[model samples]
Target: MVEHSGGHVVPFTLVASAAQAGQRTDRFLADAIGTASRSRVKALMQAGSVRRNGTVLRDAADPVRPGQCYSVEFPPAVAARPQGEAIALSILHEDDSLIVLDKPPGLVVHPAPGNQAGTLVNALIGHCGDDLPGIGGERRPGIVHRLDKDTSGLMVVAKTEAALAALSADFAARRIERSYLGLCWGMLTPAAGAIEGAIGRDPRDRKRMAVVARGGKPALTHYRTLEILHGAVSLVACRLATGRTHQIRVHLSHQGHPLLGDPVYLRRVPGPARLLDDATRRAALDFPRQALHAQSLGFTHPATGAFIRFSSEPPADFHALKAQITANSGSA
Candidate 1:
């Protein structure tokens, strides 16, 4: 008998026989499950979906014992390919090899567990039709990079395999130019400097990123303050030296000046909030999402080998937020 666990949508128990004893856990499970491959069983084991008795089993090479009961849980399958949607896109440039666009706030980049439709990928498929070549896989065709759902900015999508390979290589080599505009709480000291840290998932909170001393990838951000509004918020321009998930947000927050309206990092009302008037403070506090935008992107054209760059002003909401904050200072 095996100990009971919860939250498994599809689960089945398999008992090891004397003949199967001493065999590798993953191999035995793969043979018993029949439908799942050895690699798939290993993946499931790694994901903590495989359990022996009551404890989660992760090591695929662990030897099985006779009469031991193993429980395997299978997650629900998702659509093989995302359906195209007729969502509008702000196209900046288009060519045979690539398409550059200004992504607005709240547009997800790819289809995921919670977001299976109405994404930028679906819109691209509709707009490009048969011209959109599958870059990495069927799931996120031609997607070389991504912007967060709430971060508005310029993005480049590869249209062909060659372009995808080249652009991906360029991004990996840090040859691609990327810059962002972020409004953060408080007047950042020195006004211009670089922030360097290694970023990884926060151990305390898996859903958020944090600067960790170990098991983290190196990240760097160079920034200069463009404006200081009412001594409370500062509009800053940031250039990326290395791309990492939430690199700018994590780095800036680690520096004690998280971006304004960042739901994940800005957990409380900043001390600088007192600098603003009542209405301005309320408006700034009520701002919905992070005040960060990918303002510019530059990279060499994969087909033509020509360097091209594109830039966009911050969206109207960003402008309005800044204006509201700066109104007291007569700098709107």
Candidate 2:
């Protein structure tokens, strides 16, 4: 018989059994629970719900002999209700530790002055409920990183303190890899290259990000041409080594290839790239916002310590733009 001392009751569904136990406590737990922390198992022992032959056991350090049936329960998960709104989300992956969402254009990352609702944070709050980690203040509890208001793509959020710390560290250390898909004007010279510059608020236009001369944080973006549309515009993939604000936008703009429809950077449209037809040129002039989409993300799991990668297809607008490129390719 084992002791039945109980503190926090955690119910677990037993799945399998070994040869009734002749094993070291840590080894047995490791075998029983694939990759669960030993400290968590020790905590279970302290709570005393772990049992052998229907009696509570007290020592996670206790040696075990063969022929004893062992079982344990886990604490109940805290209940929190996630608000479900009409806001659609392109959820790529979700777990206890985090959630990855493919944010679309026209959605801001966080709430701010004059824009409090209809943001990704607000949508996440509605979706994650009270389970979201409350670190980045109450307004943005689980938010770990950000994308600009007009940029869209795969973004991740932490659900727990450990996950938040790990994910933040991964970003800071540049261990997390991100790839973006975008369309920019002109036939890019060199076809593929890297852009390194300092980024700060524009002195001329405070609303836009600029590659400053004296007082901006350093930014770097590496880009490769994916396709050439009508021999004029190039669909590109930009990889971020250091995620500075408006990095890809500023870098590409600095390279003299501002994204199509990017109002702030390419204030005046350059003459159509040789690939544009009259109708396509008209469409380019009326297009709004820089075409940027987060297409890929790779990072390590905070809990399991396993590497995970996710990808998303370019959004509808991106495809439409590509279609226009293909349609007018031979005409140019």
Best by lDDT: 1
lDDT of 1 by residue, 273-309 (tens): 8888888888888889889999999999999999999
List, in order, the clash count of every candidate structure.
0, 4
Among these predictions, the greatest TM-score belongs to 1
lDDT of each: 0.90, 0.78
lDDT tens per residue, model 2, 187-269: 67888988899999999989888999989988888889988876668899999988888889899988888898887788776
In candidate 1, list every pair of residues with a backbone clash. none
Error of 2 at 46 (Å): 62
Please report the TM-score between candidate 1 and the true structure. Answer: 0.77
Candidate 2: give the clashing pairs: 10-73, 10-74, 10-75, 11-74
lDDT against true structure, model 1: 0.90
